[model samples]
Target: MANRFLSDLDPTTAWAKAAVDGKLFTCGELVRHAAECHLRDIRHGERRDRATPQRTSDNMQWIVNAVRSRTNCAGKILIEGASFSSSRNWVSNGQAAAFDRLYGPAGNIAFSPHSYYDADASGTDASCVAGAQNRLDPPLSWAAVGDREIFIGEQAGSGLDAVCQFVLPAAYAKLRDHPNCIGWTRWGGARRRGSTYAYRLDPSNYQTGEDTPQMKLLLRFLAQNP
Candidate 1:
């Protein structure tokens, strides 16, 4: 409607006249145009991420910093903040630093450096081993975060022992024994690989009323670490 209306007038002068010529415009047209622009601005604001990046990052930083300090967790607590989530538009450096100070003081907060293992990249296990020793431990690039309680949070396998066996024992120990490492986290919840939803490890699903082999492993680690 706006394009059609503007097309009938002198292209050059019509726009300029719209700014000053009350004679060429009606009150209804002016109100409707204002409403259009107002709606446009409103929609533009809505298109932004669920929250502003800085705001989300700020919240993330707070959550990261509080990992060690959360009183709700009564035992030795370790957190695995994934290396700067690109999809989430958060940088790794900032996230890494949030725990840097914490590690020095309390040694409870730590981040999981991405090896791209679960990301289906080539030779991820090798990458995980290297990161565990190099960056995930003390004297990493951010030297402030030295020898702290580091956790490798992954429930190995692609939801099956067969899948996890390929990476277990072989690559698992290197990650567990890496310098400064304290424990592990199994991402054994719900995961998708190819067309199948990887096995769900809700514990209750087991007929023996016991943990699956994977749960047994994680539980053993917790028992030993705590």
Candidate 2:
């Protein structure tokens, strides 16, 4: 609708006018506009990752700094993708150290590392071997700097075995004491179905199943500790 309405006018002028008018816009529209504009610019420019190098770098840095600023100011921050350093380098250099140094008063920060515990357990290597042991600990890792609480946002949640269940109690017990280190939260909260290696509430129907019982259990554990 917005695109069609602006079709009769200059696209650039229309966008600027809409911004100046303070027109109500949804987040989805903003993302759509950004993606379309970026894609178009890419198509028109040199076909390279560094196409529009300065503008692209500045935009990305602006986003990263804004998020980092917010995280530094907040009491709790949830992080992911640090473990898989291979895919898309999520954490920036010195960012972790900045978080650690800045939040040194009450230890109010948490770092959640991602892992597939079951897969690691089945592995025969040394590194994978240790991960198999850490699986004995809660999959989530929370780090407190000063009074700040930091927690990992996701954890392995597939192929349940006795060892996997065993790690929860001690991890939650420690988290309970911090008064800020809340219990580990499930990534998807068991929403998917037929996710044999993924986290889901109902693995039975693989479509519609009540994972309420499992969620209720998690809630109870958090309430007792938090």
Candidate 3:
């Protein structure tokens, strides 16, 4: 059986349906019971910092393997991290084994360790680089899959110049050697709603809108290097 791509109608509901249809489960009763047990454990954990019993059937790996064994899902299985989605942190403990057991060794799938940046406090390039490096440390396999040292976030008019010229390239220089470190993309191509931050990297104020000076610099670098 090939791997399946399963997401939620709602995750809990989807899990129940998948379990029943796959025949690993005979009825929704067991599935709902398992979910209730899991939620109770989660709620208990929030109230007291004590250990919670693990749900045997609803663990992501169990679902992944069951669906993979039964369905024709061939795409990469994007999993929510253990912190939010599962009782156990499978990736931290045994990522390779967990993924292999579920999806097999075809190497068609990749894992995305969700990482983000908050520029509200305003950080320097060095600080941003350090932060990204820290995030990349544990999820090293993402580098093999396709990770980059670029920050993709919202920026204002002048901010784009700052990011492209100094911030991004500096970070890229730090981590560009890794093959999976592809590149960065901005969160929004243009400013939505209303913002003082010029959406156009090169607006009328500048000669070229999208092809700003920073972009030229980037293109030149790519052409020269590549």
Candidate 4:
């Protein structure tokens, strides 16, 4: 998928020629792609194994190199080091140094970590764990120590309770106030028809155009920050 995406952005490729004719993305625009390197534990016929942190770091390095080599794209890659299975501290455990080596004086790459306030640190639940707002503190500190940029590429809470009202806002504010943190992308929007996902951001009706409680909370934060 990365190869295909990069090829499409290569100006010399046929796909790029066709896209340019159709007025697609220009080479000057800052293109960003997220590589969600989630640690996976696979089970096959009673055999169970999980991806090693070293392997994850190597894969992410490959993506960073690939993106950097595409000089024509003028892009950046958001490399994820944390997910449901692996907590935010995964970046500090040797992966940060590995990424620093790959980045190597370049400014186009940043660490992209997912944050959730649930009991398992997975966004699947609506209720937040205790003191969930401070969950990203360690990872943020690690990023600062490495002088690395961070982008929260995916984050969301399911309910309009404390998870959305308190925890989500506080966590987002941390990202906003942190100098090393660049930005964040909220998850749970743009669902397909009839989908029952908990974090869907659609309004009740197109005419009413009422923001969901979660959206309202996020928008309020944006207003204050802006």
TM-score of every candidate: 0.40, 0.42, 0.39, 0.70
Q: What C-alpha lDDT does candidate 1 achieve relative to the native structure?
A: 0.40
Which lDDT values do the candidates have, in the order given? 0.40, 0.39, 0.39, 0.61
Candidate 1: list runs displaced more than 4 Å. 1-77, 82-107, 112-116, 120-145, 159-164, 190-196, 202-226
Task: Specify the highest-lDDT model's number.
Answer: 4
Q: List the RMSD of every prediction in angstroms.
A: 16.8, 11.0, 10.9, 8.2
Comparison by lDDT, 1 against 2, better one: 1
Q: Write the per-residue lDDT of candidate 4 for residues 61-153, one digit (tens) a residue.
A: 765565566554556667765223233444555555555555532557777777777777767677776567676787678788888888877
70-135 in candidate 2: lDDT tens per residue?
Answer: 455544434332223111111332223323433223333344444333443322111212234344
Error of 3 at 64 (Å): 2.7
Ranking under TM-score, best-scoring first? Answer: 4, 2, 1, 3
How do the residues 32-68 of candidate 1 rate in per-residue lDDT, one tens digit apiece? 4433433333234325432233433444455544543
Off by over 4 Å in 2: 1-81, 84-95, 101-116, 119-142, 188-198, 206-226
Clashing residue pairs in candidate 3, if any? 3-73, 4-73, 147-181, 202-209
